[model samples]
Target: MIEDILSINQRPKMDEVEGVLFCLLNMLFYNDQKKTVETEQISIALGKDFVISFQEDAHRDVFDLLRSRLNMSNSKIRQRTADYLLYSMLDLIVDNYFIVMERLGEQIEMVEEEVIRRSNTKSLARINQLRKELIVLKRNLAPVRDLISGIIRSESDLLDDRTTKYFKDVYDHIMQAYDLGENYRDIVTGMQDLYINNVNLKLNEVMKVMAIVTCLLAPATVIGGIFGMNFEVIPYAHHKWGFYFAVGCMLIIPIWMLWVFRRRGWF
Candidate 1:
């Protein structure tokens, strides 16, 4: 449904009025300006007797609820002035912002649980993605907060004191959502730090084990190197049981090293 908000300014010129009425009735118009509808600015102006809404896009309107209220036989909108209608529409938009925030909050909670339960690479990647989404959401919401604040403080006759209070409430919700997003960002950062520390600890453990193994083999390697030399003066070289003697040395050296390591609590 289309909602026509007549401005309290001058009535349209006779020639222009027919075209305006035609566009309003047809609900579609072919104009060069219409091509920029999605990127156009939207503004609502309130005058003593009427409300004027300027939309860049002629195809999209933000008055669905207003239209439904207006259709009701005993609707309060019918008895209210244009200012009320404009305020109502603004309220609806602000309400939708909260709805979006609610959904985002739910998603963030799920991500938080995942981060806590598992700090793997996949979880880290998901946290990064959530951080990016929060950044975008914050960017969109910051301006909206400023805009609502402007409306609340503006001297527009369209919004009564009660409506101003409502805007303030909406602003508070926006602030809360912003805070939540920031807190989640911090939590994700902390999770990343934790994951790094865990990986580093595991690496240190493996290195310690390798160092112990190298130390335990040091004596055996030294014995083998001496026996492998072709020198004739080496002890036990001429013995008939020389091979068995070297084998015994190899076994005993490791056992002795292990006993020393145990005594020193190296293991």
Candidate 2:
């Protein structure tokens, strides 16, 4: 059992062996200052007389509030059986899942605003990162939900009948968290689509400007080509105002095109 808890590749599950109930659970915590999600594994064993828990990270955990409650002489946890203590621990872990979801929601809102105000490479990268994080969240959530359900349905003598209702409550919380994860995944996908469309719109605007400039230069090129031809019969080639006529055509034609464009609302 210790080896299973120490394994990095272990997934959330439940087992009962020779009257001992073993639970391997995943815990998710949100770091607000760093805008990051932290994951850890918690292994719990419920024997006839005692409840033992092992955590992967000793530096941080979501069990502080539970510990404070345990220190109280009149605490309900003190008056309960080992199964109730196990339920309390699992309940705390599930509650933190809600906190992680709330943090992720805030990040999605910020990314949505960034997508709208200015969709740049940085925004795209952040969107991808959020998608990846959501995937991790979802992947762990389903198994934990199943693990809880298994525990609730188990017929082990170690689990107290009175504590079953508390496990059911935790089950409801996990279900809600799963639903919220699905909604957030859809929102992130929509944000990515919005980002792509914004990039395309900007490109189209640049191309439109380039097209208008090209059209205005067409007249100058035609007039110069005609007058510079080797043909001796070219019109206005011998006039005193020939140079001025060509230059004036170059300026006048572009102005005329600009006026036509504005009148038609092309720009």
Candidate 3:
């Protein structure tokens, strides 16, 4: 049997298959920091008396339970056909979809909460990364789902009568995965909307502050302009206390504006 498969850095070519029944299951491999998902394919070929599986490497898998059962002398799998082993492997793969999606669901909840509370460039970046990863997952998973469905519908001796029920269970899991993808897509959309609304809300606050400050300074600018005029009969410009009066006017106007703003609850 093929064990855990290596990731894309430098993977060895898989051996050619020569068999009547072949199943290729590509799983999503996720990286936390990068929020990346890569496809890790597990190739399984079934024969009348033996099952051959190929993987990237030697990592442990969801098949540990089956392995333990195999260790037991009188386990049901030992009594069953090799096709039963194939079903067991496929069932494990489907069961794993639930595990991966559960982790993703937690991540979605965390991101959703953060988006609602406060958002930053980093948070948005994370959200975008998550969306892309989900897209990749969906793209890789659809073909596997179709392949399983086709197997269930096909009249093939490769799948025995006893394990047909198990394959159907795997089909249910694939359907659940589709539902999860749709739900997460909606959630990602909601996160994007929340992010935009928060940004616009911040901008509106900034504009409001600028508008209030501009209104406070408008009178001072007008007074200063009038006093600095080149005309000969300027009243305040000629007065001994002209400078003091102009300064006083500038200060008082803004103070009054502040009071008005405070009373009107504009600030």
Question: Which prediction has the highest lDDT against the true structure?
Answer: 2
lDDT of 1 by residue, 1-267 (tens): 123333222211111131121111101111233211111234555555565666655666556777899899789777866656655766665555455555555655776676656657877776676566556555555665666666666665445676666667767876776676677668667766766776677788899899888876887788889888999798887789987988888788878988998999976
lDDT of each: 0.59, 0.91, 0.76
Q: What tens digits encode model 2's per-residue C-alpha lDDT throughout 94-117?
A: 999998999999999999999999
Which segments of candidate 3 are over 4 A away from where they belong? 1-19, 32-35, 240-245, 255-267
Q: Estimate each model's TM-score.
A: 0.63, 0.93, 0.83
Per-residue lDDT value at 199 in model 1: 68
Instruction: For candidate 3, write residues 1-267 as lDDT tens digits.
Output: 233233332221212234457676665555566556655667777787888776665593567888999999999899999878888888887777677777677788989899888988877987997798788767755766776776777567767877878778887888888888889989998899899999999999999999998998898899989987889899868789999999999999899989998999987
Q: TM-score of the candidate numbered 2?
A: 0.93
True-structure Cα RMSD, model 3: 4.3
Candidate 3 displacement at residue 131 in angstroms: 1.5
* Clash list (residue pairs), candidate 3: 2-53, 2-55, 4-56, 4-57, 5-56, 5-57, 6-56
* Candidate 2: 10-residue stretch with minimal lDDT: 2-11
In model 2, the runs with Cα more than 4 Å from the true position are: 32-34
Clashing pairs in 2: none
Model 1, CA-based lDDT: 0.59
